[model samples]
Target: MTKSHDVSVQDFNDEDSNVSSNPTFESVLNARLSRRNILRGSIGSMATAVLGTSVLSACGGGNDEPAPGPVPQFTPIEKLSFAAVAKSLEDKVTVPVGYTASVIYALGDPLRAATADYKNDGTDADFENRAGDHHDGMEWFGLGADGKASLTSVDRGLLAMNHEATTDEKLSSFFLHADGGKSTLPRPAAEVDKEVNIHGISVVEVKKAADGKWSYTKDSAFNFRLTPWSDVELSGPLRGHALAKTKYSPTAVKTRGTINNCGTGKSPWGSFLTGEENWVGYFARGAADDAARGDKSVVALKRYSSVQGGASRHGWETAGTEDKYQRFNNSKTGASADGSDDYRNELNTFGYIVEIDAYDKTKAAKKRSALGRFAHESAVFGKAEAGKPLAVYMGDDSRGEYIYKFVSEAVWDAADASPASRIAAGDKYLDKGKLYVAKFNADGKGQWIELAMSNTAIAAYAAYKFADQADICVNTRLAADAVGATKMDRPEWCSVNPKNGEVYYALTNNSARRVDATGSQVTVDSANPRAYSDVHKAKSSPQLGNSHGHILRLKEDAAGAAATGFSWDVYLFGAEADASTSNINLSNLTGDQDFSSPDGLAFSPSTGICWIQTDDGAYTDVTNCMMLAGLPGAVGDGAKKTLSYTKADGSKLDVDTYVGKAPAADTLKRFLVGSIACEITGLAETPDGKALFVNIQHPGETTAMANIANPSKYTSQWPSNAGYGAGKRPRSATIVITKNDGGRIGS
Candidate 1:
C-alpha cells in the first residue's frame, strides 16, 4: 500500500490515542533532551503506564549536539536501467527481461557424495547430509584453493545460508508428524530426528564458470551442515553463567546446537553470525513447571513467551522420554538441584547469536550471549575505524519490541579484517561489549540508552529485580523496560547504507496498534503514527492497524556507528497503488512499484542499491510476495506530509509526520515475484554486484493438513516446475540471478 492507497482519514478513537494538541509538536521537539522525555517518547504509553521514573543515570547524557564525520563514496547509478518485472500470483519465479534466474540448491538436496539423491518424498533418510528447508538469510565468501575463505576470487565462493524452518506438514509431507498433528504420546522418532537435523545452517561451495554459469559443487569438501544435533560451545558474556548450565554440559560452557536460525551476517573476520528467532515456541514447559521457579524467572520467560506450562510447537518432546527428545521440555523434572538434571535451562541456551566458522568445519560454532538475547532479526556491523570500537546494530522482530546495538570494548584494527583466526577475533571483541536500546525522540533525533545493571535506575526497576550483570544480560527485555526503550511495530531485518552508514529497518505490519476493547494495544506514537482501516479481502472486520508497514532510517551523530545520538525519519510508507487515499501511501507507489509488509532488506555494498522483499498476507489475493530493487537517498530526503481521511463518524483526523520523496520507476522498481503461498526473503549479492541470490521460502505452505494425500491440492509447484526439478511437491530453494551480458546487476 502506498501513501495514496486510501482516501479516508485515519480513525484514532482508540483509548490510547494521544492525538491531543496539549503539547504541540514544537513544544515536544524543542523540549530538553532529558532522560524523562526520552523514556516517555521512546516507550510511548508503556513507560508512563509502567515505570514512574525514567532517568537511568546521567552517564549516557542526551547531548543533542550533532557530530560530523567523513562522507562515503557511493557508486552512482544515474544511468542504470532494467525492465521492471510485473507482479504475478503464478506458481513460478519471475525476473526482469534481461536477467535470468536459476535454482542453485534446494531443501533435501544431497550435500555429500555419500548420500543418495533427495526423492522430494517423505521417505528420504539422510537429512544429516541434505539441504535444510526454508532457506533464509545468506552470504557469499570468496574461496581459496585450499577450500578456505579468500578476500578475492569472486568466481569461486562459499555460500552460507540459514535453513530457518520447515513448511506446513501437508505441503511437503516430509518429516512432519503423521496425520499432521502433534502427538500426545511417543511420536515417530525417525521423523522427529529428520525434522531436527534439517534446521540451522548450510555451507556449500559454488563456482561461476567462464561463461557466467553458476553451479554448486556437490562433492566439495567445504560443504557442511550445522543442524540442531550438532555440538556447539557457549561464548561471550553468558558463556560461563549459571543460567547456561544444562545436563549435557554441566560446565555451562557448551550447548547442543542452534535452532530457528533466521537472518544472518558475514563478519569482517570471515565468520558467520546466525540469528536465533522464534526459538521459545520450540520448547515445552510442564503443566506444573511454574512451581519450580521464582517469580522473576517466570516473568523473564513470559516476556520472551517461554512461560511454564506452554506446549511445544511440534511436540518434539513427545517423541520419547529419552534425553534426546525430552530436552525440548523446559519443565523441572529432575531430582537433582539447579534443574541441571533436566532441560529447564535449555531454552536460555538457544536464543543467542551463534557464530560459525564456515571456512573451518573442524571448529565448533559458539553461541555469543553477550549480544543480549531476544528475537534477533539480524546483526549488521558498522564501519570499523582504526582506534575506534566496532558497533553492531540489531532489531527484535516482534510487535511493540525494541531496537538494540552492541559496542565492542576493544578498539578495531584494520588488520583484523583479514585475521589469522576469526574465532579469536570474535573472542577479543564480541566477548566484551555494552548493549544499548534506542530512544527515538520527537525532534527527528534518537538516543542510544545503555542497558546495564550499573545504571541505578535499572537496578531499582520494580518490574523485574536485577541481580547482576548476567541477570541483566539474560533478561535483556527487562533492562530495556527499565531504561524505557522505544517499542516498534515488529522491527525486522536492518541494513546499513554502505554509502553513508545510515541504518534502515523494516517494521513489518502490526494489527494491534490501537487501544482495543481487550486492552491489548500499542498506542500510536511519533515513529509509528498511523492507525486506520486497511480492510483487504476479509471484510467481516476492518483491519484497523498499520497494515502496510513503513521503513525507518537513522543517521548516526557524526556518521559514526558508536554515536549515542542520531537523526531519524520514516523513509517510505507501504500502501496499495490504486487506493483512494492521499499520503497514506507516502511513496506514491503505482501498480508497478507497489508492495506490503517489507521484510527482507539489503543494501548492495558495491552498487549502493537497496533491495526490498515482501512477506505479505494483506495483498496475497491480488499478488504474491515479491522483491524490489530501490535506489534510496540519504535520510531527511523529503518533507513532512500530513494526511487526512474521514472516519466512520464523518469526522476527519490528520496524521502529520516526515515522509520520503515519492518513488518513481527509476528509483524503485519491482524485480521478482515468488511462487504462491511463499515469502520472498534472504537476499545477497556477490561483492562485484554481478550475481544476486534470492531465497524463496515455504512455497505451497498454506496447504491444509487434510490435503496431504493430494499433490494436486498444493498451491504451488515452484522450482520443481520452474525448470529446476521435476517433483510435484514445492521446495524452498535459492535462485541465483545474473545479467545476460555479464555486467553488474541493475546496471
Candidate 2:
C-alpha cells in the first residue's frame, strides 16, 4: 500500500538508485515474524545448535568432524549473565526482569524553561524550543555541574540525538495536526512550519536526580535544537566550490538547515557526527526540470532519487511563496537550464557528515564534505592512538549501496581529543581525507577503492563525466559506482569493537533481491548470499530480499584503522529460531535472540557489548521490535562456507562466503523489546555502563488517519499507556534503563 512517493524512504522504494554494473549483493526477498508465546530452553536444547556441514565445517579444525559439545558460542566473548528478555507484543517496553526502563525524555518535552508543557494533543507548537519527534541515533556527552565537558560526570551530561522526520502516513503528518492535518496538496503553511521545526538535531542536558531518577533539565544551557531554518556552513572540499552554491548561498560557503538525520556517532575530538539519510525524498523535482538539466546532472539525480516524483514528502513547498519554503522545491528544473539561479544546488549541500561540537552550541555545524556522501547511515571513527591516522567508516542506508571509509590526511594527536576548540579539531582531521569504498571479493578478501579524482577509473569515466574533485565529492554515489564498489544490502549503523578494534556493520534487510532474472531484482552473490522466501513461515508479512538482515564485520590487515586491506565475514544472520533451513539461520539464533532488520548497532565503550536494534516489519506478527546484546569475536574465527540454491529453471547455483563463529544463548540474547509499531532506534550509556539510554521511535506508527480520533483503535498508545506522558496519543521517547541493584547493564 505504500507507494515510494507517498511515504518515507523506510516504508517503500520505487527507484532503483544503484545503477552500477558491479555484482549486486542479492538475496531472495522478504517477510517478517513475531509471536507472544515464550519458548524456554537451554542453550544446547534450543533448535539454534543444528549447524550442518555446509556452515561450520569451514574452520578446518584438526578433527574430521565438529566438536562433540553443546552449541558452541564465540569463545572470545564474555559470558552473559542476565536472562534473555522474552518477546512481547504488549503496548509497552519490556526489558530483563531486573532492569527498570524509565521515560527520561519524550516528544514535545520542553527544552527551555519558558516553553509551555506539551499538551500531547496535535495543537502543540513551538517545537523549536521543545523536543522534536521520531528520536533516532543518539550519543552521550558527559558534562560537569558547571556545564563544562566531563569524562566521568554521570549525574550531568548531554544527550545529542537526531529528530529523524515524523510519524506520518502518506503525505500528511497526521499525528502533529489537530484535525489529522491535510492529506492533500497545498498543505497549510502552519502545518508545514511545525514539520519544519520537528526535524534536524537536538542537544539536551539529561541529569540524574538525588532520588536516582533520571530526567532532562528543562532550562539547561546545553540544550538547543538545530531546525531546518538554522544556519549550517559547508566546510572542507566544497567550502566555496561552485557545485555547492545555491540561490540561498550564491558564494557556496554556507547553507540553511539539515534534514532526514538518521544514525549518529561521536567524533574523536568530542564532536557529534550525524548522517543525512534519504534527504532526497524531501525535495520536490518538477516534471520539466529533468529535461532542462545537463545530461550528466540528470544521470546523477536519478541515481540519488530513491523515490522519484514531483511530489515532496511533505507539501512544504506549496505552503508559501517565501524562499524559505520554496527552497524545498527544486523548480530550478523549470527555470534556469543550468540551474545557476535556482535551488538545484541546494540539494548538493546535504548528505554529508555534519559535525556539531557537543560542548559548544556557539559553534555552527559543518558539513564535512571530505567524507564522500550518499545515504549516510552513520560515521564511526575507529580506535584513535597518539600518532596514527584515524579512519571513519560509513554505510549508505539503501538497498544495494556501498560501505565507505575515510582516512584522515593528518595523523592523530592525542591532545586533540581535548583540544581548545573541538570544531577546529574537526577541521583538522575531517576536512582533508581520502574517501574509499569497499569492494568485497568472492575469495573472502576485500580492498578499499579510493574515491579520488586522481584515480584513473574516476578520471576516465564515461557515465557521469567528473569535472573535478569537488564535483566528485558532491556526486559521491556516482563516484562509488565508477570505481565498482561492492553493492551491499541496505548497509546501516556501524560499530567498532573497543576490545579488538574490529569493525561491525549492519546490513539491514533488502526487498529488491531475487534468485532469477526479474526486472530490477538483484541476484544472489557471495557477500549477500541468501535469497530464500520468508512467506512460507511468516505468512502475515510476505516480503522479498533478506527480510531478516545479517551483520558483516571487517578487520584491518594491519593493526591500524588506516589499513586499506581487510578480512571480512558475515557475523550473525538474523532469523526466526524455527527457521527450517540451516543456510538462513547460520547464526543458530533461538527464540530469545532472533530478530529482523538489524538497523541500529553500537558497542558499549565500557562493557564491550554490541547492542543490536531492529526496525522491522516481517517479524512484527511474532513480537515487537527489540534490541540484542552480543559479545563479538575477531575476524577469521570461522572460515568459508558454500550455500547452494536451485533457481526457478532448476539450475543449481553455489555461493561461497565467509561465516563467523555461530552465536549461542551465552553470546547473544534479546535484551529489550519495544511497543507496538515502534522501532528500537538510537542507544547511549553512562560512562559507568550502569545506566542505558534507548530511543523508542514512532510508536503506533501504523494507526490509520481515519482512526486518529479513536485512541482505542490506534496500533499503540505507548509512553502514554505506560503513564509517562500527558495524552493518550503515543509519543517517541528516550528511556533510561538500569539494574535495580545498581549494577552494570548487559553484564
Best by lDDT: 2
- Model 1, 1-747: lDDT tens digits are 111111131111111211112212222221111110101011111100100111101011112212322322346575348867766767877777777787888887788778877676566678879888889989877765554556545567778999887764321234243345433345567667878888889998777755566778777778899988789998876777778778888778888888887788877787899998777767889777777774567777777776566555556888886788888888877876665687778887877888888888898898888888888778888887899998988888766777899999999988998888888899988888889889877667788988887888798988788887777778887788777677677788898888778888998777766422124455555677666566555356556667778888988898485788988888878777765345356677877778888888888877888888888877776778998888888889888766554444455545466777777778888888888888888987776688898898888877665665577887777767765653567888888888878878888
lDDT of 2 by residue, 9-109 (tens): 34422335785666664233221211123233333322111101110010111112112233112223377888887777778788776778888788998
Q: Supply the TM-score for candidate 2.
A: 0.91
How many clashes (backbone atoms < 3 Å, residues ≥3 apart in a chain or on different chains) does model 2 have?
A: 18
Candidate 2 stretches with Cα past 4 Å from truth are 1-15, 25-77, 306-309, 333-340, 536-541
TM-score of 1: 0.88
